[model samples]
Target: MDSPHGAAVKAEDFGLKGPRGWAFRGIGLDAAPGSLIAVEGPSGSGRTCLLLALTGRMKPTEGHAEIGRHRLPKKMAAVRRIAALGPVPGVNDLDQSLTVAEQLREGALLQRHYGAPIRSLFRSRAERRATAAARIDAALDAAGLDLATLPKGERTTVRDLERLEAVRLSVAIALLGSPQLLALDDLDIKLSDTERTEVWALLRSIAARGITVLAVCSEAPADAVVLRTGPKEDGAGAGRDADAKAEAEPAAKAEAEPAVEKDSGAKKDAETGPATATATENDADDTGNDGNDDNDDDDTKGADDALAEAGRA
Candidate 1:
């Protein structure tokens, strides 16, 4: 099987607002076909949402994008047909109980049944089986997975495989479709530095074959096109700092006011004491109200969870 020509990706102010809030906003990207594109960001920073949006698994609310010739939010179905997801949690996950060979066979069967042309199904059963085998072999080679090196070879279950090996298996399954665009989430999670480097090498090799690779990671490889996601220029940190200051201002004023009245008589104490104390209590209540502002960023996580659940459904 020959390698497919990769898909070109372009986006401008691409954003997705979910049930909670904006998952990602103001994203911009333009990459050529066969490019190794890495989506780098902190956890809960909408990295996964951006990956899904680019792959057509999630729709963008604010901006527009193009995957190959397919336009986003409108041509999502077409984009999905050309893009394959690799190891995205809660979406297209591998079964832990399945053996290595079983996983590969299942991927191959799914691709053959839905991805392949209807005319191809007219072939004899033996021929179809042979073709599926060839596809599996090609995908394994492209993904740099050698099953013979595993502890139990083809019989090895997913839970028993090492981290790098599991990643390789997922990539191989994605390759079974010969997708023009491959999107992988959490590419560097739970792996050593050496393994991260190796996995980047593997993705680069796949790109060398003219397949566009979109990967999500905490940090990106030097050679890949990097896109970072997070809060806007008017960031969340500044807002939190401002909120903290607002909460402290009344308390500071309340403390200073009582000091000036210390030299007053008992009558002054009776008159001003309750008022000062009441003001201080009100300030404390206000501070507690301000604390709720701290939870604004948590909405991003909620949005992500909602999207993940929608994907699974």
Candidate 2:
């Protein structure tokens, strides 16, 4: 279960920009604590950037937000502790070489060292180890992942795990500390309709139990608090101005975009952790537990919230 302190999220006049233009900028919304918020938009529409800002990984250039009791760009450190990411390409990808158990353990260690109460650092090794084990178990259960059911049990390498299993494991790791808010990107990117339904069910259950969830989808379901986003021009409508602009600067626009590769091809990005899929244009996230600095790339700080990783696994 999430901590009893699950937070409500609110934003006003929030925005972030890049050299190409605004990634996303607008007046934000107010959501009741533990509400399910879906950010829906097409690729390059700034869904990923929006997720980063809401979670406090990226500071907004224009407005502000209240995540729980903390404020953005001010108390973002607190926001970082309460919110975590799941399967955000470039931020939370699985380490394909490691077994499921190993990933869980590593994630637990990372969360404990960076996310838990500072007093935990003073605990005895044995006590910490026991706590970590229990943490993993609870998170796996909460995420609906039963290690024993896997083909090789917990010993299965991420390389061998099925797509759904990979998704579950990614979620399970993010829940290790039972963060009050969970942010999952690319919610409908890879899964089939049935798989997407199952994932939504899982997210709903997580939210119902008091952990707020922010999901990215091509479109929001009727039941969610939807935050629709896309490229800057989307807000302006598909009029002649938008068409003319794109037609006039296709090459420049394409060069400036940080591509999200959905195909099987893989290439490494700069500055973030290993395993990040190369962007045809630029980079923003890395898949794994480590994030990057804002200055490192035009992409938002990848590791600023929940050692995010990106990977098919």
Candidate 3:
């Protein structure tokens, strides 16, 4: 398969907010097509969210980003069609029970079913199978994965493969769709120094093929474009604090409301002591207040006015 030109990625003040707080914010980035963009940050620094947002899998709360001619999040579906995710935990993790061949076939089938043009679905089963097989082979070659080297060759389950091999398989699966932009998370997890170098080299080679590669890692390769998503201390913390304060204000008002009402009611009751007593006595003496109807009405009206004012407070 020939290389496809990748999308140019650009962002300004990009941000994503979650229920707890802003996952990431104040991000600025610019990278040309086919650039190997490294998202360098610690574990909880919102690197994953940034990756998903860039690929249009997750929407941003503020600012904007452009993937090729498609703008996020308005063109999220468009961006999603051109971009693919590789080995993202909780998003596209490889199934441990599936064999290498099974996983590759699954990817090809899913791509055909969802990503392919409507006319492609009309192709004969044999033609479709051949096409899938060819794409799988091309993907395996691009990913530098050799089935012969594995302990069980094509039958090797994901859990049985070594870390690097699993990574390669995941990349190959992602490549089956011929995505112009590929995003990978945790590139250096549980790998030795030599393995990390190999992973970076693999990504660089993919980028060299005119495919944009977005990789998340603790450190970035010197030659690649780097976008660092720092911890919450870098502006996002203030947003979280503001959110907390906003929530707290309503609860504080609710608590203070009852106290104010009680205090006002007590103050009004004390000031209208005689009126309050007379009103209570009139309530107990149901039919006897007709004798001095004018005075009784005056006391009752005064007490009612005082109660209404207290309730308003």
Candidate 4:
């Protein structure tokens, strides 16, 4: 689990404050090297902030943390040097305008400039390019990003990628630095159930290869150390907590209902619906139109029109 820049990251009662309020407070972690840590919480609950704080990209106003040999706040720069970030919004992010290969090359250049010895600058351009290529290949392999599988291979722009594919590319770019710890924010965001499972498995595989991983998710793997953040964690009365939970349940259901209802309604309409402008039209069709006559043509026409409108939308 020992790495040049990798070490067990530990935090003791660490916390940070933002303009809105406390991002997180009284949080703790004791992740071993190469272990997977999941910071689980809802939206705007400081999961992303906690990941940055632990990685030394963000300062913790209270308590302390250790990343590699560096301590937070005091040695923020040193900590950032060893930790690699993925999709953290303002910190480190994949460039949407660049093709996959271009991004990889950029990462390799940055790594060499910062990580290599000063004497390496004297190396021939060809040699440096070769070194960069090797590092990119290794990093991509570690990240499980198969460029060949992409629609345009390495030439594909980042904006065109699937959520999971983009995540992989970001992770691969981070790995180019050979970071001791790989930390990603919002690992499960906008991903399907199967994709989430695959991402967790990928993180686990990265950890198995001796790189530490910190991921943010709404739900953590069973074996992961879960750090939760939210509005309800502070002191609160049992009555108030109950009230909050009672209130929150309906809100959550309300947020989820539209999608479920839309899907179910569409399916029902597809199965049994016959479009008529008025109730009388249905009655007229039922009585005057031959019941024995297959109205399949009319049904098919309505369905086709509906499908066309949906397509245009």
Model 3 per-residue lDDT tens digits across residues 1-313: 4477998999999977766566688999999999999999877777877787787555567788988877765555556657877776544556698787666655554554345556666878677666666776788898999999999999889999999999988888777667779988888999999999999999999999999999999999899899987768544443432332233234323322332223323322211000000011122122332222222212212211321211111
**lDDT tens digits, residues 122-206, model 1?**
8776777677677777778888999899999999999999999999898887887778899888888899999998999999999
TM-score of each: 0.75, 0.73, 0.74, 0.71
Please give the TM-score that candidate 2 achieves against the real structure: 0.73
Highest TM-score model number: 1
lDDT computed for candidate 4? 0.60
lDDT of 4 by residue, 155-226 (tens): 999989999998988887777666778888778879999999999998988888888888888899998877
Cα deviation in Å at residue 201, candidate 3? Answer: 0.6
Give lDDT tens digits, candidate 2, residues 125-211.
677666666666777887899999998998899999888788888888777757778888888877898998889999998888788
Each candidate: RMSD to true structure?
23.0, 10.4, 25.7, 23.7
Error of 3 at 312 (Å): 46
Q: Write down the lDDT of every candidate, Cα atoms only.
A: 0.67, 0.63, 0.66, 0.60
Please list the residue runs of candidate 2 whose C-alpha ends up more than 4 Å from where it truly belongs after superposition: 234-313
Q: Which candidate ranks first by lDDT, i.e. highest? A: 1
Q: List the residue pairs that clash in candidate 1.
A: none
Give the CA lDDT, 0 to 100, for residue 53 in model 3. Answer: 70
